[model samples]
Target: MNWYVVYTKPKWEKKVAEKLSEIGIVCYCPLITQIKQWSDRKKKVEVPLFNSYVFVQLSETDRNLVFQVAGVIRYLFWLGKAAIVRNEEIITIKKCLSDKSVSDISIVSYKKGDKIKLESGIFSSQNAVIQEVTNTHYILVLESLGCILKMKYKKDV
Candidate 1:
């Protein structure tokens, strides 16, 4: 069996892997614990190493089995063929699972109109207004409160 990268629905990597496993497709979804601060309390949550994607350990030769797993949009391939991930990256991700201090907090780029929700901190539940997009953070204005705050997000978050 070989590991093939699968592109799944947004926020569905973990679920997809679980479903695939139940149907006899082995998967490896590396995860790390992230501390999220929401107003009064801070809680640690497990998150995937890569968002919207995960690796499945299956036989690429078995095309029928590959296509049967639910939530699996497609396998990532190189030059029209399935591309397997190197063993080292998997090892690195496994190692990161134990690192409590490690986190992904970089903000993604924003367009003229994009929907976003605060992932953490004081404005955790408040939706942000995209005022300006920057390389490091998004300049968001809370229209109702008339306060502008910059939320930092990681590229991997």
Candidate 2:
């Protein structure tokens, strides 16, 4: 079976993936661990790499089965066709996310107005645009949400 992309409710990728798996559907929900800091303490948490999206391997006949799962909204479509993700692409994503060198890969030089995929921290994997830079931090604008964030730069990233 080929892989197809599924859109899910907000913050439901993991739950949808688990439910699909329980019913014998093979699903992939890539997750990344990042540190979340609060006023009192800090902790590392696992979050979905692609928010609100999951990958499932199934044939056309199984589409309805997937739709039956809670939190699964619909298949991602392009030009009225369900989007098919190539196996190699999935493998590459898995490799990039699972590698021990992920931290090294996260470090990047960004410029003003450049769109960046947040690699770690509480906003891990969120897309934002650089608005300003300082010697010690970056000012990012979350364009979609109309919010601004200041992130401190760390050597290890």
Q: Which candidate is the best by TM-score?
A: 2
Give the alpha carbon lDDT tens digit for every residue of 12-122 in model 2. Answer: 999999999999999999988889899999998888888789999998887889978989898999679999999999999899987896673232467898998888888
State candidate 1's TM-score.
0.57
Using lDDT as the measure, which candidate wins? 2
Clashing pairs in 2: none
Q: What is model 2's C-alpha RMSD?
A: 10.8
**lDDT (tens digit, per residue) of candidate 1 on 39-104:** 999999877767777887766577457567667788787779877877777777677665667656
